[model samples]
Target: MKFLWTLFILMALMHTSSAQQTQKPVLHGKNWMAITGKPLAATAGAMIFQKGGNAVDAACAMLAATCTMWDMLSWGGETQALIYNPKTKKVIAINALGIAPTGATVAFFKNKGYNFPPEYGPLAAVTPGTPGGLCYMLANYGTLSLEQVLAPALQLAAGYPIEAQTANSIERNKDQIKQWPYSKKVFLTHPGENREAPDAGEIFVQKNLLQTLTKMVETERAAMKAGKSRKEAIMAAYDRFYKGDIAREFVRGCQEQGGLITMEDLARWKPLEEAPLKVAYKGIDVYKLQQWTQGPAMLQALNILENFDLKSMGYNSARYIHTIYQAMNLAFADRDFYYGDPYFKPQEPIKGLLSKEYAKQRASIIQFDQNNPRIGPGDPYPFEGKANPYTALLKKRGYEMDTTKRNFAPVHDIRNTSSLIEYQQRLWLGTTSVEAADKEGWVVSITPSGGWVPACIAGNTGVGMSQRMQSFVLDSTLSPFNVVQPGKRPRVTLTPSLALKDGKPFLSFAVQGGDTQDQNLLQFFLNIVEFGMNVQQATEAANINSNQLWLSLGGTKNDDRKPRPGQLLLNNNTPETVRNELKKMGYTLSFGDRTSGPINAIYFDWKHGSFWGGSSNYGEDYGIGW
Candidate 1:
């Protein structure tokens, strides 16, 4: 990021302006609220709420606003969400993850003499699902129309300040954007010369994106005058992107650039409405997305951790960290081997993968006195004979183990590395999340990602493909997650969490990063639930990552051999005594200025009829409530 150094100088100046800095997170009143990666986006959602929209509407608006600003998170990408419908008194998981093209078979890339598509380009993209997913959320549960919720984003695109976050991302990805002519035209130009990043507070206009959004509005208007209902009018825009001319435009762009997406793939696409993968931890019901993401891994880790007395061990203690790491190792091993699209038979049964009995069986192996550094996937499958051998066979074919590799740079401000999108962030670490709740008890938690690195901008449309295809592997080995098939969604890492206490909504939270997302969430949960940290304290607390051997979704091939459970990155803020204790237990460790996972959260206090909200100071996180 070229402007990073400049931004740092400016940031230092801001810090000096205040006599003292308080680490405590911000507070909010008991009313509707929205929290996200940027103050501007949060304000956009808050505006929707002020205008009489509900949580669903506010969250979707926030998501769109974030997408317009952060190319690293989404322009076109996957948006996975968890919505709590107060009317139904239940949580719903919206699997708005994109899918592989009908033509994206393993042999297609194999013949090209590559292990997979290059990290970022047209070939790496999947059909984009962000718009479609937002449309669905609005049409189904939201009271506001698409035009209403997206109004802020459209206006922002017309002319908005280039905040530090967006400026940094564009600077970091400038070279790559230059490779695609259309991408270059839209993101990298300044009338006559090449585009330079707009300074933090300077205005930046996205005319191309503005035009694209305008077209959607125009298409919607045409549908309405033609007698289509409001829902139908929204669908008209969705259809244009997924099945009409816009779909063909993407197909055309892909074909011209040696990519495989097609009209059939886009037309056939529709975000799925599924039950959340739910689990109970210390009398609270926690809901995360299904296996299509690593959301369930949090559930698995929580299940294993339940067998221990965490409070007795004390938070951030060696015992606590080790137990959590071991549990994460066991859970992530299953994630690599078993988590995938069940629709394609990812080998493991959904019930068995999340069963408490299975968790107990896996948890029984942990030794609190020592570290279990590198255990592979345990037998989550109940029926030995019935278990398929696909994943096992593929391992024999030389894919090595799929783990997130760390090409970590020297310790620096994490905000500097914020340019990374979801997968690339597994190394540098990043993502985008939004959580909003209304006075009516309706709430939504979502993680939106892709359309940067592993993704390339589509031709002329100002939209890009989500690099979710990088999450999928191409082989007959039946790697639950990597295989590609027509309409098969790649297993993603976007997970949002919701917790209910006493059968009532108590908390909504999410984080940005690849595998670190769950880890971040886990730390926050314990920070509040066990250590009695307030929402702000939990949000600001330093955390660690179990990232030794793991490879991220969209991860490229790494020649280096890594240890199982990998090396741990300890946040110095957690105390050196605890770090030394973990090393004594045989846990390898490294250090960083900040934790890998950056989180935003909201806690509902039914006893007081109020809410507390907190956002990360790490980078873009901002919180607003009333």
Candidate 2:
């Protein structure tokens, strides 16, 4: 009897352990703040927190570290952040988006008698804005010294192990890196050796970048000692990067390389402090980056969703996916047609594009059984649009009409009965498309084009400048409209996002794909806001129907591979049983790997007083915290 009792106890204990292992890890602390990015980046933020810094200090530390660890989105680039000051209970948006160079008007290219190249040209680059933005944030909110915030990054640059993600990103951009001697030297092994990843503990150093950071630190410190106030000191730091010796050398490099940027342009660059875009959903208030990116469109999506009974629609069901896709189609149509920097054009008419009244009318247009016969922009606003009343109200007040009425061409249509049959036959064949979306509601669609060339030519303080112009589209249809105008920021697809629950900030999410920003964001939102899953679980979910091609490809019926006008891609997560049911309902389908971009999120649990952060495992990256 004693032996039997002991055996039963052991069995019970084993079962409990198994259950715990499968459950999501729960981390809690009131004063605890977490930064999710590369491990080294997180470590940098953790250092700040340990030293009595707040969230802003930690964020600055992490940003600097990422500049060294993930050069793709670092200094000499652009960064937009949505800071929620728990103390003040107020949220502020920091817009660091670069503007068009002084001499870079669309007519300049036309006068030069040169067509824009699909990748890398004079038109692809924007003024680097990260430095100015960082300076502003530090001066206004940070407690730690600039040297303290920069120490981790400088140390990492001096010598640190190259993480797997960094190695992979380097390998992917090898062709571009080869174009610049400095980049090749730092990123690759000697002459012709293939780029290699440093072993976990291997020390990797970027001597040039370290020197650059050191210079900035010294200049800023000297300015402070010279009796400059915090703001002046910060501005001085910016001057060191954009107008001092660094600026001179960069301009010289640009002139030597035939790039368009000048010292004046660099000196004139300034970060904007605009009101954040906000929306209310399910009693929670959500905010986004602004009109410069797809930040406002996300609120538009949520507003339309509010009109539907998503919980009853069943998660990932054809009906749920289709409804969400239609909403995105309408929102994106407006984004491409009307959204741009308001400072440049006073009559651009993008305000109220996603108003509730607008969403209700748009939601009414989605068909339950048949896919939309065509895809295009909805009706224009009834009145002359202005930038006031906020993006959320705009979503509620915007007009809704037949999208096909606009000149926008349709990419897919579900009206083709034959395409549906073919897709169904290949139901087992896999299709994939990887995408990324963030909670900050700032989407970046970086294309490799001419705008990025200056970065490579100038060599930003030893760190390679961004070569992100590869994401620009060269389709003749968009050519007439694609000119560099003064004060007009380039169109970007990098869309970071925020999700709200019960009228409060719920989650911050972002993905990393040039044109795949919105596509990835839509699917991820469905997984959580609709499907009811944790952050990690939602991130790991499959990608089936992307917002970009869903409408033209026949809703959620077409195979993701060779997506036709009315077909939709379905991944393994759709379930065999449910998939067959959809096929019987005349939907075309194909199987594929769940292709999604790397997603990073920090979820707030107000009820529990804790925060959870996670990075996508699908990518070679990890999220860490203390």
Candidate 3:
């Protein structure tokens, strides 16, 4: 009996160790790999790569195709990307985020009785960015012509079988779609019918969008015929979009719909190529965009977590979850109050915010036994050799005066069950991610979003306007650094990431949930780095999301922007013991089968000289490798 019991125990251990499985197979490629939010969009990237284009070219093609597919975004959306340039041996940031149009001011919105900008329609738009962003990236870094890169998108505009997710979303939001003339004209093919929106898998076409793309391609061809360089030809197409016929129509439709966008806003707005911020964890260097995005918060969390023995705590253990939650809340508190447009007045204290010493200071105050619901922004100015300028403002707003002690939570936390559905829709609002890599060592990770379903079309252009302006706050008390102003870009939740190991490309990854992006990303990184999981395993790994920060989207009034303290989203597979432990620590828990991400990623295997692609099973995210 004793010998049989020992054999049974050994067999059970072996079974448990080998039980790890994924819903989708890990994609292996020798030459190239492309991943995105939709299968057809990934095919567009694969098409570009097959045409001998590099990673940037393939990524641009995927971006254009996804925009046409309306994968929670469109051409008028904003784009933020992290590109690894082989020649430069450095990661570069693409700041294609649109800025507030002229006449957009705090007083302008305050007079309208809005706490934040409206959530939809033309009034919510900023200047379009993705079109210029795609053009600039292609012209500078890509080896393909604009015509070739835009071919898939043009075809998509002409006609393609619409997917169920998008078709259903349009049908559900039909009433809002009816409000916009151009939207109703395009989306509701069978107007006044029982089911006006296109049925799933039905052929959906956008003639106006097809015409707009045709015009740009013609301009590019004309520029080339006139003896222009490749870059110049692409720029000509860009000029046609921003300063020519397309711009005029966009502004006209905007103004007719009582929007603030003007010709100057279109002409003056251009995509910027900037340096990305980086932080070293262990030996790997992680890169993210600047303060204009919520990316640095992840860096802050990493810095704080470095002080603890996370691996020793065990994966998804009670202590590990508690530690991660505390660290995220601490970082997010600072993000809520400090993150904003870096180009504007009163520059963000990024130097101090990302300081290792500041991270240590913030980490030292965490209560290991219970959740701290009163976590608020900390004073980072002192670390940067400056006095805390927001001291009075912090105290006046009931924040902790003692920088080292626990702080009061944000002023708003109204819980109303009636509006919970609306709030959740905005909080977990979806977008799409693009990841591409090729044999040349070039890699691209992009998180582009803004113009989603029910978006107001800009005139006969068939281009949806961006609704990114809602990210801005009207009251300085809500965010001193992110107040609404003309020409200032709103601090957005979109973030893309790149990591380098031993001075070579290691991982390129991104995801599409609003505030939940960084939270999932943090865990994904740790899963690989600490737990020794492969790229695919890490992507599908469970993650916890903290809702302790102010709502960044979907708020019409002040109460709607309130943070839900102690709220945490856990994976449904979490052990009951872990759940019980978290409950005792004051966390209000919610569970979902797919709690983490529809993350898309590519891992560069330097030793094997190949790529490993990962597309999580949470959504329709797909990938192709060859």
Candidate 4:
């Protein structure tokens, strides 16, 4: 009897572990729900649904909790999303990204002789959009009071056990935290001692943040009772944050600390509604987050991929990887040169850029033997004789160029050096300064306080405001015609996307990594749509990335910096069998990592009426629920 009991206990332990690995939540009875990333966030959403709130209400609640727990990914500094509405049966895209203060202008920096700064500070900081976005959702679709939705975040903020992932992410961004006194106080001790993970059941607290949340709930309630509709009341909360006493104090703090925000900029900030970009792939309608992100670029890549037989090429095969890289390069050629806000200027249609005719034309140019020194736009229309001027120019210029003529030139040559030598040379001479200037940037924010900040400095009302600053980096590197202009939003890579199949939503997804966003999204989409894999398997699949000129995974580099192009770095991990086969076909191979981007998604199946959500376990995170 004793032996049997021990066997039963061991079996139970194994079962529990297996269940965790494959676990998913389910909601039945004509409604579906799930949220990826944090378990606390999922619970918060579920609680809202139990209270008769729809998807919007649940999502708002989830957003609040995420803000409290997943500070690295969710905060006022990030963007917001709303994918579907049951009532309207229409998709809405909200631009919750922060913008620069009104005083921010290219001329301001040019006059100061200051190039763009490398990190987020008051200068790089835009108006936060999370608060306004949350209020908008609540006013339009929520039923529960803001206070109820925010309770979880407020509680979590007061204290929750520290996880290993959270600690690591905090440490990585320690430099950024050091800039803000409040951030330092909340995240670190006097000497910045590294704290160990809390015991399994311990609770932690964030007193300052809790106080901030409390004020917002009280202020929102008062405004609603005093002759304001839900939406207006929500807007009033935002106004209080921007135009009221709160703005004064925040601005004063900025002034004292040499920050660049003003009251007028806060007053003028507003969120815009934009039409979503849609595409058809294999008879299925696919949607993207519109011009606010690189959704169009993802669409372009997919359209180009439609021309290839990726499955037959086998998983992670060099031939398969090379073909995809070439296709991506073709797509990005147009993106880097043409894509931007359509409201301000007409964006050249990338569909033509990735058409079947164009793909064939570009594919024909791929040399399996000696690497081509440069890659061009190829023919935009293979059937027609209309030449792509971009391709012709690329051929004429080659890839390599003398840097002395450019504004920032390479002062020394450090080629064929060891890793340490390269690092030192890079730090000392900065030959790659121009190359360094061309990378992507992103800011993510989550707020559980119901689209408002707590009243620590706002005098008892709880609302926060965001500035719109993502517009600073719009235009092509090659074309002066595409320079940043007034009233134009930047070409962003931020996407909060969801995938649907067989008339049901299959994935609630988004990737957080600048230029790598679309590349990550594309790989995940393929893993599910073509390979028939589960969420975790698909997310963990090997990935590849290309930013127009250089393909990172493949063993070649198509340099955009010079006239003579073709240089690549192949990952050593690339399978030898695949490499030999590709080499026979004249392709090179290099080694790379799987760290393209961070993905968060919830997968739901209608047949089982079950929901499964998962965040990247590779990063700092916490999953909790009952």
Candidate 5:
């Protein structure tokens, strides 16, 4: 009788836990679905869809709207996307991430006594990429004209009611905004008033930005008048932004503010469309961008986790958490060292890093009893039939052996450490995601970032300069692949994902968080495939985050950006038993009510021939489906 009672209670507890995953209802649609960081931005995508646009056109509109709204990014920001084309039956990557301008070499920064590039202002700027990226995507895959696609963003540039999140951000960072003359003129509406930033719900206007966008549209219209093809017309607009008067003003503004961008830098840079990398996990194939971004870290993690029976361990179980955390750290360690620009360098051993044998070799070092604070990058060259040239450097840097005495500071100094962690969280917190899908089998997943608020506006263009230069490292000892160089792209945290099953689109997903992007994405993917959760549930479901890898953003000093291994973030509602077990395994735990980050995704419901959209309740992420 006692055994029966205990079994009943266990079942009841499991049911209750499962019920919590449905905090938000699953969004269903038959024709199309558009989801992004803000409701207004999603509405922009929907407007395009309602006007007979496909997923690509809608996605470009959403990207423009988000950039105009300063949804954690701006016009000068970079964009990274993965698009699943139904006609071609292939997933293509958009490498619109900005490159370092001339004079942005490691020596240039090292001469300033800096560990990494500066975090903000014109000095931290990279050449803008989003404008050309949107134009390229629209011209190649979209059916609409450039002017038609940019209507919503042009309206936004004219004026819109600013949200409190953005208004307050400007107010909080007003001191820094004042450092740049153009930014001061555009952001500080009240000038000498105590509250210079626009108040929440106030109509915010950018005349200069509106004019700049108008110039692009006008160029497109003029090109059409000249009997140019649609693609040629769009390319004309791209030229105006890069090599024309807009570029001249942007360069003038950038250089006027102690920036390094030259006219040649803007004229030379162009977005690339390349084949994406993929790895098969179970029966499903997951695709990510090249090694330039951290997208492959998730692929590596999935390959490693494939060796274990994760479903058998149950969701959020202490053992499951430890396994996921370990696999993520292992993958990220490789990312910190090996992932960078493919166009530069001796090249990354990507073939070996994504190999099943390499995954198994990395997985073999995992110890189930306690966290491995000294987890480091693995040697992948052997699997690709090449010698490991960095073996000596790895050993010299103390990453070849386990020498960590403690992963957490002593209890007496916990408060000071907490303050630094809070700052680190802010640094790792930016970017917004876009996910859109249509009944025609077109899927788009984009993680666009850089040029966040308090941004330094480059000249009279009213476009914020990219702060992406900070993502580059000055010392080759840290990441030989990611060392700063003129015209080279930095390894970034923005990653978008796509998955296919049985030769069809299965899922398109992305999230807004720095280093935590892939960590949340990996668990979200598992929540659906392994745990049988609906799209919405998978997005909102509680997941753990591991801070055992190097910081990818915001630190002026090397020590400030060092990894804090064994530090784990768990949902506050985690069972006491699970918490105790994790504690026993040497995890220094932190709790949050929401830890999944803001994940936006679209799942193609093949059986029903519909679309399922998921927008996490963690932030302002929203979706519109019809």
Candidate 6:
């Protein structure tokens, strides 16, 4: 009877613990705080600030520890960072994007019978940038050496309890993982026979990754003994992967498998640091990564919306949400058309795209009565002094060019039957973000991606290369962002955000959804700036649909692969009447779920000498200030 009672108690405890994972996170501190997708990593970052490390050091440590989460980020992945230095009053964009190999030409894939690189495998892979990025942060901006910054990640890689989400990722990809012996050895319980992912709450240990990191640590130590400076010693560790053994193995893997990467590519590849693409919005200056990623999509959306009274549109009302989605679609269309690797197209198109006049033209295209059948790219070329042809088209429809609008009274019946099939909500999360602000007025935000678990492992180096090459478009008809070429980093999707007010740091934020990164962050910002929600309220708010559209090749049942128009994902909180009204506008609407934007945000209220932090469903995220 005593044994039975003990078992009953254990069961009760297990149930209680499982319930906590679903609860919203609540954490705030004053004096150096770190918040990330994982709890341990957040704490690890906080620990660094307490140890007298700067925001860059805390963020570097946090990013390193974040590599343990294979579902979100990997040790060998692509990474981008935005650092704000108060003294210099400047923001730096780190383009730690993995580059296509010297041999990754369009002909190579055309000969392989693929329209593009296969979504999986070494051919889709690029040289990872995560390690080199972390080391770059250490050598340039950080106060701690790589030996010190790498400690938390090394500790976690040695042994840490696996969360349920991570275990599920391992199990779902177990079949693909087992085919690669090195991957089978690292992520599963045992090779082949016990190949399933470990049960959740299991103590997961990755000795292989630990060994790889320890070798770098050893290199750092050796350099220190050889009389290297702190930064030089840290870079010695960094060189272990870029110019050393790991780079050789990575190149060898591609060579053996007939993939394109080479050691020379790795050796010459350095993370690019440049000034941010700054855009002025509502008196606040917003900064984002350059043209390489989709960061500009957010800026373009804000610029277009600035023409309208977004505050007047009741927050989250059907009309308000529709306006936002319409603006998003317009921005995405521009992104597909104009954005690309600035290195290839040295003349970035931002000068024309972000201009207030350009935005006025785009905003004028939004029709509120009925959803646009499809919104594609617009010509942002110099709009002659004469009104744009779009303005003329609206005037022909008896609409004015100014904000005092008329005629949104339903041109076509939305309830009219159009053969449209609904899509299931997506569950793809292949990247992670981290941010930190020290009491000393330094801020950092980074989005690290590329090294997903079911990816290339670089010939036993345990370095997972990115399939980010999939983001490239083979044809340049839409934009030069297309047209793959050797020695070019494909246009990427890792967008991080930083905001400044009155020349002072005001916000540091990021979200993790490939094409949806800009979509979600744009909405979250509106939720705070326009809707007046606090940090936590803004985070837990629902995202509009991410897979709500596809390009419309031909609008019929036969054209499902192309863009589907007027789809919205809403939950119960959205009134039934709103759904009916949207449907009446001819939209293909779905319910029961919304997009997952497991986001975290930190606010730098320097004026008040405090910070506000909030995140969606929590495992290890917090916002603290000191």
Q: Using lDDT as the measure, which candidate wins?
A: 5
lDDT of 6: 0.72
Of 4 and 5, which scores higher on TM-score?
A: 5
Per-residue alpha-carbon lDDT of candidate 4 for residues 1-626, written as tens digits (9 for 90 to 100)? 99999999999999666534522322222343434345566677667666766566666766776666643343344454635554455556667655555556667655654333212444444555666677766776566677777777777877877554455445544665566555555555333356422333456566755765666776778888897777777667667656776567666655444556677766776666665666666765566665545566677778778767888877667777676666666665555555555555444444565355665566666654533434544445334545444554445534343222211111222232334223222222100000000001001112121111110111122222221232243213332223344334445556566555654455556655444566777878787777766766666556665433421111111221222122223434566786676556534333444332346555655575555444443332222211
Model 1's TM-score against the true structure: 0.89
Which 10-residue window in model 6 sums to the lowest lDDT? 404-413
Off by over 4 Å in 2: 1-27, 107-118, 121-123, 194-202, 383-457, 467-483, 499-504, 522-528, 543-569, 580-592
**By summed lDDT, which 10 consecutive residues of candidate 5 come out lowest?**
407-416
Please say which candidate is ahead in lDDT: 5 or 6. Answer: 5
lDDT of 6 by residue, 1-626 (tens): 99999999999999666533334654455566687878788878877887889999999988888886575568767889999987788898888888887888878777776555555567777777889888888788899878788888888888888888778767867887776656677778854555478778888888767778888999989998999988888888888888888678777865675568888888878888888887888888889998788888899989988888888877667787788888888887777656778888545566777778888899998898987765777766574333233333323423111222111111121222221111121122567778788777888999888767675566767667777776665545434554577777877778899999899887788877666688888988888789876677677676675333322111122122133456565554677778777777766655544443767778876656777777765233444455
Ranking by lDDT: 5, 3, 1, 6, 2, 4
Query: Mind giving the per-residue lDDT tens digits that candidate 3 earns over 270-368?
Result: 999999998999999999999999999999999999999999999999999999999999998999889999999879999999999999999999999
lDDT score at residue 54, model 6, on the 0-100 scale: 93
User: TM-score for every candidate vs. truth?
Assistant: 0.89, 0.77, 0.95, 0.73, 0.95, 0.86
State how far residue 594 of model 1 sits from its true place (Å).
Answer: 2.2
Worst 10 residues of 3 by lDDT: 405-414
Query: What overall lDDT goes with each candidate model?
Result: 0.75, 0.56, 0.89, 0.50, 0.90, 0.72
> How much does candidate 6 score in TM-score?
0.86
Model 5 TM-score, all chains together:
0.95
Q: Which candidate would rank higher by lDDT, 4 or 6?
A: 6
Clashes of each: 12, 78, 0, 51, 0, 12
